[model samples]
Target: MSAHVRTPGWFTVNVLNRAVAWTARRGISVWGSRVLAVRGRTSGQWRTTPVNVLTVDGQQYLVAPRGHVQWTRNMRAAGGGELRLGRRVEVFSATEVADDDKAPLLRAYLRRWKAEVGVFFHGVGPESSDEELRRIAPDHPVFRITVTN
Candidate 1:
């Protein structure tokens, strides 16, 4: 049997989740998009979470803080969903970026979110993932959503 290390879930999650809440409240935005719409695999509930939208070469993506989080799961399950940027909502098909580009993407993500990443990383050093993100994520899977706007 393979053993999986569980993601950190103590005070760390509490704090980072608050940031997520903040983004959700203020309608946080990135790359001109303020929200990510991921559907529930089983229930088909359309869940929109305010996320740091990162774009690379014109491709839009959400670098999930926790890879194993439901958002990623749904992204994988659905492969395509909707994105709401202001009142414009459009459907997009998602594809997971392979590990080869993880480092580059991570660096781009850090650049777009250095302040929050600073708070998130704390003392993890520039070479490490923040505890919250590292908990369920460290090596992350990038959810690239194709957009035609």
Candidate 2:
């Protein structure tokens, strides 16, 4: 199977994500929503975007359904970033998980966020077999989050 890399559409970028990000900024967590802030790799300035932070087994994760995006690249170079909700911000370091270890996390993420991000998964949902998820794991980067301070 090929990798799934989806760009956000007009509705997602302008309407849905904006609404969610706005609400989240007001301290309202719309299903673990937050504005992720990471320094741009080249620009060296903070770039922000709304993302769903998935917590599984007492650990938090950031999954990139869009695949190898700006934030993902930035996180790779920066090694850490912040998750903001309203006036609250949590600084954290991130480690990208190897593709082989992403199935469970991917499954959990899809189980929680399928309604919003399933389209990016290309028909692979939470119910997908481990093998199925493993095949597509390379496309979606999963990062384990550890709070810094």
Candidate 3:
């Protein structure tokens, strides 16, 4: 959690996120997108956002491409959340991955989402070296999640 959060652009925060959330809420997933609903750390109310779910080697992961943002902070405090794709809600627990273990997950994530989230990565891509990935790993928080119910 030593990494600084990268604030998103006006379009991302306003237009793009809203459109994606609207779609996901309607039961459509755009590029593995889902509506992530977790309790706010202080408010104790459910907060929703659109997120990309990356699966590697049969393991599911949530990578914070924009670094340590609000949802990541809430996830840390809540310990779990619900992934909503239309009416299907998958409740799950999350474990934050250490920086040392993030390289591979980040690589796979970039491979899948580079077109959409590459800008937030500061020029790193799926083709980047592991060393290069590790260099930026601390900035991106990753969570390994298990579906509980």
Candidate 4:
């Protein structure tokens, strides 16, 4: 297990994810959920997982609440991926956000999905101080993405 990754529990992996993926597959988005599809760095085959898309000031982002997980690693290597919502697939390019710049975004993310992903943030919530957010920023890799297709 990587130091940056925090593995989710059985319930989240089996039950919650499946439910979200199921709904997103059929075109229903739950709290900005989307099935992110990117190619594996080594295998070169497409890999996917459910992710929350955060939009602030018209810009879109993907924050890895689970730390540097597989999809985040893959996204770094692939430099882009697809956001799938049922029959709608939007291809996009991704740029990793600097850790220094993550605090505000993370705060906004917490403001929106704290109930669901806050646990992964290690007690940090929307109300956390900027210093507190920055302390954990590296553990949560954030990406700024733009849809190209």
Please give, for residues 47-134, the per-residue lDDT of candidate 1 as tens digits.
7665677887887777764445667778888897777655667778888876555556666776767665544433333356544334
lDDT of each candidate versus the true structure: 0.62, 0.91, 0.94, 0.93
Better of 2 and 3 by TM-score: 3
The clash numbers for all candidates, in the given order, read 1, 0, 0, 0
lDDT of 2 at 124: 95
Q: What is candidate 4's local distance difference test score? A: 0.93
TM-score of 2: 0.95
Give lDDT for model 2. Answer: 0.91
Per-candidate TM vs. native? 0.67, 0.95, 0.96, 0.96
**TM-score, predicted candidate 4 vs. hidden true structure:** 0.96
| Candidate 4 segments whose C-alpha is farther than 4 A from its true place | none
Candidate 4 local Cα displacement, residue 121, angstroms:
1.2
Q: Report the lDDT tens digits of candidate 4 across residue range 1-149.
A: 23688888899889999999999999999999999999999999998889999999999999999899989889999999999999999999999999889999999999999988888988999999999999999899999999997
lDDT of 2 by residue, 1-106 (tens): 2345577889888998899889988999988899999999999999999999999989999999889888898999999899999999999999999999999999
Q: Model 1: runs farther than 4 Å from truth? A: 1-33, 118-138
Give the true-structure RMSD of model 4. 1.6
| Residue 121, candidate 1: alpha-carbon lDDT | 36
Writing each residue's lDDT as its tens digit, candidate 3 over 1-149 gives 46678887899889999999999989999999999999999999999989999999999999999899999999999999999998999999999999999999999999898988899888999999999999999999999999999
Error of 2 at 123 (Å): 1.1
Stronger candidate by lDDT (2 vs 4): 4
